[model samples]
Target: MNKKITIYSENPFYDKSLKTRHMKATIFKMVTLSSLLFSLGFLIFFLSDIVIKGLPAFQQTYIQVDVTYNEKTVKSTRKAVNKEYRRLVSRSWLRTIPQQVIDNPNLMNTKIKLWILADDQVDQYLKGHHHNLKPKYIQSVDNLVKNNATKLRFNIIFFTRGDSKIPEYAGIKSAVIGSILTLIVTMVVAFPIAVMTAIYLEEFAADNLWTQFIEININNLAAIPSILFGLLGLAVFINLFGLPRSSPLVGGLTLAIMTLPIIIISSRAALRSVPDNIRQAGYGLGLTKIQVVKDHVFPLAFPGVMTGSIIGLAQAMGETAPLIIIGMVAFIPDSPNSIMQAATVMPAQIFTWAGMPERAYVEKTAAGIMVLLTILISLNAMAIYLRKKFEVKW
Candidate 1:
């Protein structure tokens, strides 16, 4: 009993164990910091490259040409400009001459000098990119530049028009409209159902086997591949419901299905974050469960619900596989006026442009990617802003 007792803290092994644990934690922190730096570096490089490639697409080459509006020019648009410069101009622009004459009959025999869109080859040459133009066209472009007959103007047509075989006339207008309409449908269908389902599961439903089963299935659904939702849309909306193929209605329905699990899961988490004391106090105040949820719980939880819904919609916006499976990848040359018309979303349009063999479409593809990234970033920013603006401490 008089012998000195050695406590664990006095032992050398104890000190060694503590040292080892600290070393491991330090190593983990260093590794995590390195990974984060690497990810940020890659993102910066990617964004820089896209901006460089896409900047060229916003400015288009235009050549000043003499146009003689006559019967011959109306029939053969090749005669609209000088014979030498005809090869440098866009054929798509030439094709519209007949319609132009019909619209303004007074200009039938007038001669005017105006700037016209150049052919893609000429455009490429003017931009100093790799071009497929022959020596003659290159010389022509050079001469036009020297004579101040050619200049790079802001590419208004690229934003105003739709998909075209000629790169000079192609634009994302139709795709943008299609994306807007599809998202509208998706929000309209998904938001209400997802919010209600989440509220029921979190507040109203009994903790029974059926409820557990439903919860498990919904968790599983959030992990499922998005393309499977497209197949489901094809089977249900297209085959069973007889919905129009490639329409915004079908695309929206498919995306709504895919977005539902995300919103429901997020909403449930938001609802659960409210303290139980709040519900108890509501009950003590002689409020029914429904009144408590609607008046007190829901109001506090609405910000979180909206934030989740926007995030889910942003995810749906960038989805390509699901839309492709449901036939939303069609070549839509005109903006759809109704939800039932054939349409193509921005991602699908970018997909179509990226596959083209032409050199000009490369810039177009990059530009489209930039646009899509901007939109997604904006949506995510809004979500973040909303979450922070209405965050509740309790």
Candidate 2:
């Protein structure tokens, strides 16, 4: 008796396994897409909020007032404008009346209708903010508006001036200048040293205890908190070396150290990406190792190094913790033309303004943030352009 048994290769349940796999993959894709869209939605919402809150700062309300430059007017500006509209005029504007009379002696005892800055309350009312303008002052504002005397005008002072206790006069000029100067010093100090370190470690450093220790320390330094670097600057640069406490020099040097590890790590990665065969080929052609690196390796690695340096600089630009620790919170009304002068960067300035009592500073803070963002975005674009233009794939 011969019995034949047939073994089927297919499982009746295999289609369920395939369907389950596909179901898992589909769920994973949906989850990833949902997360991405959620993050993008939040970012869009945040930017829109900032734009909404900050757009009003670029234009300021102006009011036409009758100015009488007399001895009493010079002595007391409160009595200078019409008593009904005094509450609607900026004190900063009133404070300058005496000076204006002094500057132009011909204007003494003169009454002239002139356009002037509105008070914060008046400005707030015009901008649809919560303001305590009285019923009469509100009527006055409305009358001025009807007469075309109170109107929104493009504010040049906000851009041209520097930090001021008066919100209307406060500007980001000093902060912008300080940021630029700090970045200049940071790039000058960090770039060359970082590149050299990367080159030596990648090509020349041997497998030794000292080299290994150095490598480990560099990595660890990158992980250290930025505030720690600030403390280091406060200790070494300010306390020890006696450098100017709030100068861009101290700030830049601290940022340099902070950015160095980033640059070195990125540069090493860029250098290592070059094929070992390229180095061997150079050696085979009787080129010294130094020449091989200097001639071929460095050119290929520079774009990445620049990209990293720019990114590091952008990070430094937005850093407030370090600058605050190093005494950069001073009220800097005048732009510093020299690096050694006392300075305050944009982040520190924004932080300073955010804590102010005035509502106008809220707009200024957001506007400053927008400016900082613009600069960072520009730097990133430059990095991308350089990377694409100079990067060698082979």
Question: Candidate 2 overall Cα lDDT vs. reference?
Answer: 0.89
Q: Write the per-residue lDDT of candidate 2 for residues 255-277, one digit (tens) a residue.
A: 99999999999899889888888
TM-score of every candidate relative to the true structure: 0.92, 0.91
Taking all chains together, the TM-score of candidate 1 against the true structure is 0.92
lDDT of each candidate versus the true structure: 0.93, 0.89
Please report the TM-score between candidate 2 and the true structure. 0.91
- For model 2, give the 10-residue run with minimal summed lDDT: 1-10
Q: Which ten residues in a row have the lowest lDDT in candidate 1?
A: 1-10
lDDT value, residue 358 of candidate 2 = 81
Candidate 1 lDDT tens digits, 1-394? 3232356556656664777899999999999999999999999999999999998999999999889999999988898888888899999989999999889999899999889999999998878888898888778778888889988899898899999989989999999999999999999999999999999999999999999999999999999999999999999999999999999999999999889999999999899989999999999999999999999998889999999999999999999998999899898889999999999999999999999989999999899999999999999999999999999898
Model 1 alpha-carbon drift over 4 Å, by segment: 1-29
* Number of the top-ranking candidate, with lDDT as the measure: 1
